[model samples]
Target: MSPASSDAQWYEAKVPPPLLGLAGLFLQHRLAPAGGGSWPRRAAGLGLSGGAVALMGSAAGTFRRRGTTVDPLHPDRAEQLVTDGPFARTRNPMYLGMAAVLAAHAVARGGVLTWLPVAGFVAAIDRIQVPPEERALHRVFGQDYADYTRTVRRWV
Candidate 1:
């Protein structure tokens, strides 16, 4: 989702590529040695991505069941107002979880080359994906949703 407003207004800074670069290196090399042991590490990445998909899918399902629509591009739909499970801690826990998995992939095998792409991915999501969702929510939920926004963070 796109960021409706500049994150720079609230955040002090963005993450540098180097840190993300390291995640890539791990993704590519599967760091912690690579000659023999591999199954557990590989499973970890799969698990991260898989589990996140499930959780986010569940969130989507909840919205669907409630007769609400969820946009892949925004955080605005919640006809029943789900605030449980992964959602309780992070306002956009699904996205946060998915990002963690992607970052893990970078770490699992991306190395230095993965940094720029990862940063760009996050930026695009912030600028293009999140705003419409927020805007849609502003229309659907109105004041009650706005109040929730005041208490919860957009992302953790």
Candidate 2:
């Protein structure tokens, strides 16, 4: 669907991404066999997952502190154009964090099929959620948003 289209489906515009990531994690565990990996690999996976969580928390906290809306469904309610902290690195740190959590699960699980969920979550968010978010931010912030987009990658 087009980013500015108001006729977007519920899954495209309403479903929270954390739920999708959780479903993806559930599917990965249900579909893939538990993988065997070295302790270091597992530790790295744990660290990645923790870091992802931290990134998301930081992003949310930044929004809250800046008095901006954290609800992705209501981008127009944002009071400020957040560009510091995690936003400085990537435009969608929260979404990236969700994807990273899935990737961490896949890494720890050690199965090729596990990665499928990660890819799926990324694709769904990128295609369905990010477009509208970007459009709204650009509409609200105009040239400032455009400049930020030029400097920050959407998903890094």
Candidate 3:
């Protein structure tokens, strides 16, 4: 199998995004010490959490309207290449939203150490989850996908 296909199979076989985020949260809880300096403000955390919710919701809604699958593990199942809504801002709005949520939670919990898991979550999505989906999109959509990638940032 090609590397993209292998990655797609691997991602499909592994735990879903929400579960991965939860695992990262669990890790943060265990790894971070009880007390530390707070780098993010409470208002900022709340704002980020709200923005995450909005972004994810908008992206999902757009997918539904466009009749495309939102599940990244099943990129082959996508029927359309949605570029409007939250997608216009970021190629992987769902993952970006998830990262935002993670960051918000870490900030709300109040510890610089908590940011470690947020970073890990972002890295995992960027390195692991996104590649296969990108490949699938390219295979399915060709130059259209490439154009979309060029115009939109992966994460914003």
Best by TM-score: 2
* TM-score of each model, in listed order: 0.61, 0.88, 0.87
- Which whole-number lDDT from 0 to 100 does residue 38 have in model 3? 54
Of 2 and 3, the candidate ahead on lDDT is: 2
Query: Which runs in model 1 stand beyond 4 Å of their true positions?
Result: 1-41, 73-78
Residue range 72-104, candidate 3, lDDT tens digits: 778877899999988988898888888888888
Better of 1 and 3 by TM-score: 3
Angstrom error of the Cα, residue 102, model 3: value is 0.9
Candidate 2 residue runs with Cα over 4 Å from true position: 1-13, 34-38
TM-score of candidate 3 versus the correct structure, residues matched by position: 0.87
Cα error, residue 152 of model 2, in Å, equals 1.0
Return the top candidate by lDDT.
2
Q: Rate the local accuracy (lDDT) of all candidates.
A: 0.56, 0.86, 0.84
Per-residue alpha-carbon lDDT of model 1 for 65-125, expressed as tens digits?
A: 6665454433343465655555565566656655666655654443455444556555755
lDDT of 1 at 11: 29
